[model samples]
Target: MSVNEIDEQGLGPQARRSEATKRALLDAALADMEATGEASIRITKILQESGVTNGSLYHHFGSREGLVQAAIAERFLGSVTKGLAVFAHRVGEVGSTEQLFEVFRDELVRIGSPDVQTQRIHRMTALAAALPRADLLERIIADQGRYFDGAADSLARLQEHGFIRFDVDVRAFAAWFLGLSLSRLLSDIDPQLNPDNEWSEYTFRALVAILTPAPSAH
Candidate 1:
């Protein structure tokens, strides 16, 4: 069952209300970060925007840093995971390597698009913030493991159908794909350096080469 279902089934009225307040505070925190374009949010502003009490914030999150971490996990990372799920579902429907390549090519374009770039920036900012906090970093690592595992499962299905090389590790390939996509951040900082077409073609070629099965000797 989903988190929301559990919340509804298990929580008392007061507990549900508290959860609502927590949600409000998290929403306010994320909104403030997005508006300011900064990962470090002001607790006072969040409390004001959320109409949640300072004591309540401390009671729920323990500290401002805790609130920020939770916000990043729930909003920024959550968005990335949701997008991955959709992409994985699309991958599962592909009937051939050519169709899979088309799916990936479209994904490459989508990832470098302005909207996805903004999302990537937000997620990277969250990761940067989490780097200094061991607990947050651990949480992020665990989340990423699950995300990559789901992606690997999708790729495994393609492998079973002879659409991908049997020798390749799908989990590692998933991680590599993520790294390649995130590397666009280097170009993102420069306005004059749009290497979308070149990057996509090169990466797609590499992907095809890596996934194509070797010929068997007669």
Candidate 2:
């Protein structure tokens, strides 16, 4: 199920090579999605761009939808996990709740922006899966669940250590954070959703405020 599992099961070498090929295919698909924010992406172009063999593609992912799901899961999960790790680390490093939240706000904005067309399209496709393939949508949600649980674990640790406020619900916050991100994904389709590029900043600040302890009066 995981990379480690693949290694432990005696499929390490082949899995490692296949993983590289998978990354190439994902990167190629991203390039296509970035170029055009279309959900119905062309499979031939991705194969050509990645130079992945037809047999290999079919072997690794059985269907066009499967390939799309794998690529989206890998890319989106990587970013979510990476950003959450840093945010949690920063939480432990900072003393005050304000300082900790500043770190979170910065991470939120940074991760959400610099507007890469590829990422927007990738997100649209993932969200689009909800309509045509409920099964695929479930897979994407499950993929995110693993990373969100990891982040919630870190938050629980911080709360236990008194780095974060004890009253805050870590898992709920993670769900809310992800829900906000998905809602923001629609902003690309209709800028009306974002309103002024302030959604990330505003939401980050609001959520952190709720999670922080009430300041002690002098």
Candidate 3:
């Protein structure tokens, strides 16, 4: 069978052996995709690198496209969960809302690019757009909404504590910050470009300038 014609469809594992193989293949795919962005991955390369037979892959992923989508979702969703958890914990830690916002902003700046956090956003958004009718696509939108809500909640907490500007809509600001961060993340997908040159303290300062108000104004 041609590498391109691998069977696509079926997560069911009737036996332990089947389950193990499936787990290995999926794990391999997730690792590969995370190392080399989803935009430029190939099933053939995956199989070659993963050392799994086409049938093994097919039994797990069903098709090349399905495998890619699953990998993308697995890799990105896992990252999103962790990111939210960190933000949530940090928000709860501070004695006041203002400190929470400051810490959050500092954390955002502290997170180095390629901003896998934002890369997941762009990756999944593009994937869902390409396949709008898919059930998974709807789930992706829901996931993004939750992500936005998380950001908004953090912002709201900050606003409540008098950190973020009360006059500004926290949700809107959160959305804008999310969008901008994702944009910058996707734009810097290639590492050949200088990572430090385009994004650094200056970039974060600009982002803070927009999302936050001056201390004097507060």
Best by lDDT: 1
How do the residues 112-210 of candidate 3 rate in per-residue lDDT, one tens digit apiece? 544664555545555554464475576666766787788777667766766655687766766676556555554456767654456555556665566
Arrange candidates, best TM-score first. Answer: 1, 2, 3
Rank list by lDDT: 1, 2, 3
**Each candidate's clash count:** 0, 1, 4
Q: What value does the lDDT take at residue 173 in candidate 1?
A: 95
**All models: lDDT?**
0.84, 0.68, 0.63
- TM-scores of all models? 0.89, 0.72, 0.61
Judge candidate 3 at residue 82 and give its lDDT.
65
- Candidate 2's TM-score reads 0.72
Worst 10 residues of 2 by lDDT: 114-123
Candidate 2: deviation at residue 81, Å? 2.3
Off by over 4 Å in 1: 1-12, 36-40, 216-218
What digit string (tens of lDDT, one per residue) describes model 2 on residues 183-203? 665564675566235766677
Residue-level lDDT for 151 in candidate 2: 70
Error of 3 at 190 (Å): 8.8
lDDT of model 1 at position 175:
89
- By summed lDDT, the worst window of 10 consecutive residues in model 3 runs over 4-13
